[model samples]
Each structure stands twice: as C-alpha cells, then as structure tokens.
Target chain A: MNSEIVAIDDWNVPHKKSDGVRNRKDYLERLLKTERNMKDDAEPLVSWGFHHYFHGELTRQDLDLISKDRPILIIHRSFHEFIMNSRALSLFNITEDDLNHLSKEEKKFASLEEGHFSERGLIAVMPKVMKYLAAPQRLITGLQITENYFQENGITLIANPGSMYNPSIQKVKNYVFGDEDTPFKSLFIPSALYMLEHTDISNLLKTTEDHLSWGEGKVGFLPKHIKLFTDGAMYSQNMVLRDGYLDGHQGAWLMENDIFREAFKLYWDAGYQIHVHQNGDSGLDRLLDVLDENMKRNPREDHRTTVVHFGYSAFDQIDRMKKLGVIVSANPYYVSVLSDLYSREGVGYERSQQMVRLGDVDRAKIILSLHSDMPMAPASPLVLMHAAINRINYAHEVAGPNQRISALTALKGVTLNSAYVLGIENDYGSISPGKYANLTVLSDNPLSIDPLKIDKINVEATIVEGRPFK
Target chain B: MKNFIFVIALISFNVFSLCSNDRILVAKELVTLDDLYQDANAVYIKGNKFHSIGSKEDLIKKFPNIPVDHLYKDSVIVPGFIEHHVTSTASCNNNEF
Candidate 1:
C-alpha cells in the first residue's frame, strides 16, 4: 500500500472539519476546491459531513465546479442518504424519471440533473462506492486512523457489531494487533445481511466457524454472533413506524419479513446470539414478532437476543423487550444529536423527545448499554454517559425530561451493561478480582460528578491487562 | 536548661523517627469504596497495592515508625472507573468492515 496514493486520494479528508464550515456557503466553497491525486481514475469525488444539518444546504447548482470533471457523491451527515452530481448519475446511467419514483415530489431530494440521491437511490450507488473503498490501502488506512483515534480516547475494547466478510479485515487484524501494537482489543461480528447478499449461507457459516477463535494479540472474533438490520435510520426520516412520519413518508423494511424470520432462525437455531439493528417502532414490531415465534418454536432460556441501536419504541415495547429477554445496546448520543431535528422534520415533539427511552428501559428492568457507533458519535464512553444522564441535545435543551436515568444507571450503561451486550461480563465491566485490570482512569467519578460535567472529565490513563496502555 | 518533660518528648520523637521508608499518603478524603474500611484520612501502599487505609493516628499506632511520603490533603481517591462500551475498532459508515 502506497502512502502517496492514500494521502492525495479523494476519500482522504472527505469530511472537512465541521467547526471550520460555519454555513452552507462555506461548505460548498470548501467542497469546490477539494481534490485528490488520482490512482487510475475510476474513483468518485466523496465530500462527507456527519449530520443531516447539511442536507438541504446542498443544491444542484452548488455542485457545479466539483461535479464537472469526475462524478461527485455528497454523503450527508446522516449516513442514511447521499446526493450525487450529474457525473455520478452516469455511473448508474439512471435518468430523472428513474430517481423520482424513489420518493415523492415533496420529498424529492434525488433528481437526475441535481443528482441528489438518498434512500433507495443511495443504496443503488453504494456497491460502486464500496468497490473503491474496498481497495486494500484505503481499508487499512481507514482502520489505522480509526484505531489511533480510539486509542487516544482511552478505549480498550472495540466491537464491530455489523461487519462484512472481507478477508482484508484479517490482514488489518494482523497489522493492527501483530505489528502495530494497538493498545486496545478488536472484535468483529459479521453482518448477517451482508453475508446473505454476497455469499451463500453455508459459506457464511463456514467462514464464521473458522474465525470463531481468531485471536491475535488483542483482536478476536465472536463466533456465531450475527448482525441484522430491521429498518432504516430515524435521523433520515426513513425508519418504519406504526403511524408513519409526519411527512407522510412510509419507511421500508430492510429485509422482507419472511426472509428476516428465516435468516434469524438459521442463526438462532445454530446457537448464535442475534443482534438486530432496529430504529423505528414498526421495525421493532417485526423483531418482536420474530422473537415470539422463535421462543415458541425453540424455547431457549437465557438467550440474550439483543436489539442494537433500539432507536425508537412505544412504552408497551419495553415490557415486551424484557419478557422476550431482549437486551438493548443503544446509542444515547442519538437523542442528543437527532431528537430536536426529528421533532421538526419527522416524528414530531412527543416521539422525538423519547428516542432512546433509557428511563423506560430501566423501569422495565431490561439490560441496557450505550455505544458511540463512532464517526456516528465520538467513541468516548463519558460522552455517551453524558448524553444518557443529561439527555441534552445540540440546542442545550433536555430533550426528554423524565426519560433520563440516574448517573449510576448511565455509568452502568457504558460499563457493566456494555460488557453484558458483548457477553464478556465475566472478564470485564467491573473491578472484580481475576478480571483484566483494564481501567479507564478518569479524573472524576462519573457517579458523583455533575450530570452536565461528565463528558468534560479528563482521562488520566488507561490501564490494560494490569499495565498502563501508554 | 530544658525541663525533664521536654527531654522525655525529644526522646519519644527520636524513637518515632527510627522507623522510616514506609510509603504513606494523606488526602482530604480517601475513599476506598471497599467493603471493609469505607473512608480514611490516609493510606499506606505496599509496592503498587493498597496495604492499609485508616486515620493517620491509627496507622501510626499500627505501624509505629512509618513516615508520611506524599500528602494530597485536597484530593479524593476512589476505585479507577471502567468504561464498559468504548472500543478501539474504527467502525465508520455503520460498522461496515
């Protein structure tokens, strides 16, 4: 892998620092000039930002200079949608009529000439984009950069909840753990959805079997653990709901109902702990339906089928989740980031405020943990705890008042409950004897600190396996 | 010209000074968060592990000749906090490997 090829690549620095870009005009000005040194010319221009706040800010004309030569793909901050330039449209060779059918006139962010592609349109373009990103050097560098950032944040263990069966990940695993001496551990659980898309079930099962004990240094794979997405993201106004969004748009299921049930069964029967990525209430409904069916048929006890992201739910769902033995690994930062925005654009005030629903989950006695889902949110545990305890959004307003959990619960959401989600509770999470002495040495106790000040606490050091990481 | 009592006190100080090099630390409030001694004014460290935690007077009575090494009279100590969910893996673009 050549460093020169990577440093000048379009994917390099696709996201300009958010702080530097004050407004839409400033963003476009930066995008127009951003370029990369070519590596055989098949790559597209990728301008990235991390939030939906940049959604409508980009118009067709704003992409004039950037799209003139090579294809341009502007991945909005949401990761749910993307807008492509006219040149990008040529890759798929689709016209305006082809895209308009993806959404209604009122919601038509995707058009042929403007080349704004999202939802179905974005999904269509993903394969082509991934091909370029799949290049060996790009993947390695991306993981390396990600590893460095996480280490700086005092993270000692990382779980890739939804990963694809890329063999290069093995090389990455070797480089990170074997040669690079990464300070933390990495675990990968192949995305069941991606496996179904690329390979047959048998091969997927075989590959998983081989990687069951794949541990080198700190990198390892959880055998038989699978990830599936039930529905789309709420931030993009694309999550399925019982009543649907205020905009009158209906969210689509990621997998067909029958297919989801069958896929879940194959893994569930094989003794795999299934983790589903579900955001909307309707998505959750589909999951609950499957859980009930699985319970009646197989009747396994203490099976901790987990709901990852567990984004939105009605009050009734909490009791159901507990009864089904479905624990949650939620991104509390979602409420902090998306609640206010969703309130105005999609779900409305009542549902928007209660996105993560930590308090309800606590009252129902469901095991819950918080995750950064990084680059989705920073991989800082304290930051996640802050969002859980405070439930404050970007507007500095507490989005959900009663939904806030106590500092102890919030702290456990990051530590004890997180270990439970990973099924490493016996070895990690608390200060028990014989467990690895991996401690996140903080300047203040999160349990005793001011709720608002939790995120600001400084990390003094990280002790990994009884030795200081540094 | 000193009184006999002052001479006796000097002799006691010399006796206390004989036992030294015992690592001791004092804080405004030392919280072990341990089941046994919940709170203390000072702590003794044997190597890198906690040896004993108690008031300065009790520790002096227990280990008679130990001298205070470091005093953090304003700081609080508790068990090192553990972050349960933080990971070292870079999962960008929705954990797509």
Candidate 2:
C-alpha cells in the first residue's frame, strides 16, 4: 500500500517525503490538503526552513506550483518572507524588523498599547502571522480550525445545532457535498429547533413533512431534537435548582410550564425529541415534570431528551435522571473563566466545590460530554479536558479534587462522549475504518503526559476527511 | 325543591371526588412541580393553558387526594421557548436553482 510519511513523534501531522528542503514545507502541504479535500497528483516537496516571523532566516515555499487548488497561503505571507509571491507580498505592508514573535505578556500589553502591529493593533489583521480568515474563505479556515482544535483534545465530533448559513434545514439539506468551514469529522447538521421556532410551527412542520417525504437514510432533513432553555446560566447565578439559589433568591423561570407544554405537545405529536438547556437542578426538575406528563405518549429512553448545564443537579435528581435516561451535557468550559466566581461566592470557601458536582454526574451514567460553550469560553477540547481532569482553581489547587475525572475519561468526553452527544458516534470518535478521516495529532501522547500539562501540549495537525490541516 | 336540587348536586360532587385520579409517575427522582402548577391552571383540551406555579411538596398538599402528575418530575422544565429573529422555516418556492 502507498504510504504518506507522518511525524509519529514530535509533529504527529501528515506530510509528503521532502525531495530535499524542510521546515515549513510539511505545514504548507497539510494546509493545502485541508483546503482542497484530496490531492489529484503529487508535487515536488521542497524543504522550507522555519521562519518564526521573528528570528534567523525569513521562510520560503518553492515558488514552483500555483494552481486553483493552491491559493496563496494568504494568511502566513509577510513582508519579510522572501519566497512569497507578489500577490502574497502585496497583502502585507510590514517588514522583518517590524515582525517579531510575541511573548504572552508582550501580546497582552500590545492589546492595550495599539501601535506597530502590537497589542493596541487590529489583532485580526490577515497577515501579522496567519490571522484567521472570515468568509468565502471562512469555511476552509473554519473547518481546519474546528478539526484541529477537536482532534488535539480527542474530540471526534461537534454536533453544531445552529449556524448562520443553514438558517433552516432545507438550506442544510440543499448543501452539496461539503462546506469549507465545516472541518467537523462527520456531518455538522442543522438543528430542528432553529427552523421550527420563530416560524409558524405549522409551517415549520409542513416543511419538515415535505422534506421527510424525500425518504429515509442520508441527504434529507434529520431531526435529532428540539432544544429549549429553562433558565439562565449558573455562571450568571440564574439556575432554578430545587433548594432555591445559593443565595436566598429563587431563580427566574423563562417560560411558564403551560406554554412550554403547548410547544412540547405540538412538536411531540409531530415527532421530535426535546434537548433542553437547564442549568439549575430545580430547572431540570421542572423540565422533567413536563416530560413526565407527556410520558404516557413520549418515552424518555427511546426519545433521548437531553439536559445541559445541570450545574447543581442534586444527588437525588441525578438518581432520577438515571431511571429516566436523560443525558447530561456539561459545559466543562466552566472549569476555566468562571471558576473563581463560583469558588469565591462563599467568601474563602470553595463555592465551586459545592457548585459543580462531578460525582453526581459520573454516578448517573447519563451520557456525559464536555464542551467549551464557546463565546463564553474558547472552543478547545483540551481546555475542557484540563478542566474536567483538574477540577481545580487557577493556582493549581484542586477545587473539587474528589470529583475529578481521569485524563482518560476527560479524553472520552471530548471524543466518544462528545461524538455521541453530537449524534455522530458512528462516524467520528475512534480511529475506525470507513469513517470520515478526522484526526488530531498531539505533540505528546496525552496518556503519557502529566495531566496538568495537558493543555500545554501542542497540536501538530487537525485532520478532516483524511486531509491534514496543520 | 331547591334544597333537593342542591342535595343532588352535592351528591354528584361527592361521587366525582371519590373517584381516584390516575396515579402520578412515582420514582426515586421526583421533581413534582405540583406547586408551580396548581388546580386553578387553565385547561384546554387536556393541556395546561396557564400553569399555576408551586413546589413539589406544596402542590402535593394542595391536591393530596388527586393523583399527582409526574410530567415535570426530575427533568428540567422551562415554561415556553420562543425563538425570535432566528431563521424561520420557509420554502424557497422560487425553484430557480
């Protein structure tokens, strides 16, 4: 069998055997493979020495190949890089003296200072050092970014419920083959709720019915479940858990039960599962009651109703969830950003210790997955993995060490658990054959590394559909 | 005669009250919202048009005789979700594609 040489050690991502020259050449090759799915033919793999945009020599890509498949590495080109084509060079108005690798602290200061492409500058500028592109180009970049980020953290898939492009599922169904932005391992489908709500439920159902008429299997509208939110996030102190709030307040209920029931009845009758975002334990209880009323007709186990962010689901509620078969999707994102807030809520006492109860979640055997809940947090699986494994404060002290999970379990949350949660378990998750080739190449084996240094590991490559995006 | 009619009405009420309601879904995990949902809740067909809110125990006291409803038990229940400004399902009848 023909083989591709991949750095199984330090760099883990794929590359062609270089004819001679090295450095950034393999990185460039992988980037090409990510943009254009498969390679029709091989090209001369020349060695391109490393260019940090900082020290030593400026970099170069053999100025030999220029095809439709090869758009200029528009983002990586800088004024100093000698081999950059005229088009790539024209994009950047800076020089080598002006370009230097930014230290973590220096980058922070630059964000505040604003001059010479430093902290106070437009960090989003396409050229400084490979800035992420937004649109038209977004799909290409987005897919690679998502693929790389997920793989490095062992996340096989991300079930994206909503996106701007697929406003309604018809648009998603109409999608031809693939989207560049979708670097996800399997199908990143449009959600049912996104289409149903806001539109007349009748019209939405009609659309659903019309689409389903196309027959079963693939390439048609897929309705996993309709998502509903019971209340606000716990980070904001707005969950409706049973024993009231941590404070003396009763969290607000966004919707009245009766109104919720009507929506449920309509959708349930029409055939759809409910995936609700219920943060507080009390909020979960309220949602379960509604599901119970409809239980005579709607069964929980087969229906696969889900509850997210059950930050304070009590031990008793957790037990009930086990019998009911309600899956829990936690924002492991909470391990960072919002940690101290929950920890200090009790004034010196670790409130988060009491808040995020992992033991309750693990004991339920509920299908559990971790996520960044991005925008609130950055979309990195390792960050979530680190949080789930550590369950500690920033000072490296374990916040709820007793409730911490193993690095292996944390990996599953991002990989197997997440793939199932996204409803693409069959394709993503493992290194299985006949599945879409989505892989994450980590600089170090997570199993071998110290758990605390997990987040510090470098991502060598993020592969999507067998192509590497390095 | 009026007293006789009143007595008949009372007897009918007693007969209805005597009938045991359907059993509530009892489980190790019961988050009965019998409190948030009350007897005064408006009913349409069989759906609660407007649920009166209360806690599990409180609602149990209010309707102790009636079989408790386990519809909202143990699960997170939000009242109503309305997605506004998001994409609405509409066909592009303009099959120009």
Candidate 2 residue lDDT tens string, B34-76: 2333222211111211222344465456556445544323322
Instruction: DockQ each candidate and list the results.
Output: 0.11, 0.01
**Residue pairs clashing, model 1:** A50-A77, A51-A77, A157-B87, A158-B87, A415-B84
| Alpha-carbon runs more than 4 Å astray in model 2 | A1-156, A162-182, A185-197, A200-204, A207-221, A246-250, A269-271, A346-351, B1-97
lDDT of 1 by residue, A134-213 (tens): 55566666666666556556676677777555566566555765443676667777776666666676676675666665
Q: Which one is best on DockQ?
A: 1
Taking all chains together, the TM-score of candidate 2 against the true structure is 0.51
Model 2 iRMS (Å) reads 19.7
lDDT of candidate model 1 versus the reference: 0.65
- Cα lDDT tens digits for candidate 2, A1-470: 01122111122221223231124555556434543554543322211222221122222233224333222322111111123332333344334334345444334322211122211122223233332222223333333333343444333334433321222333433232134443332333333333443455556556544443432222233454455556544534555656553447445444446656676676666567566767676787887777777776755446666776556655667777777767666766555434554555411244456445665677656667665544233355666677777776544566666667777666666666665665655655543323344445555555557988977866554545433344
**Prediction 2 global C-alpha lDDT:** 0.44
lDDT of each: 0.65, 0.44
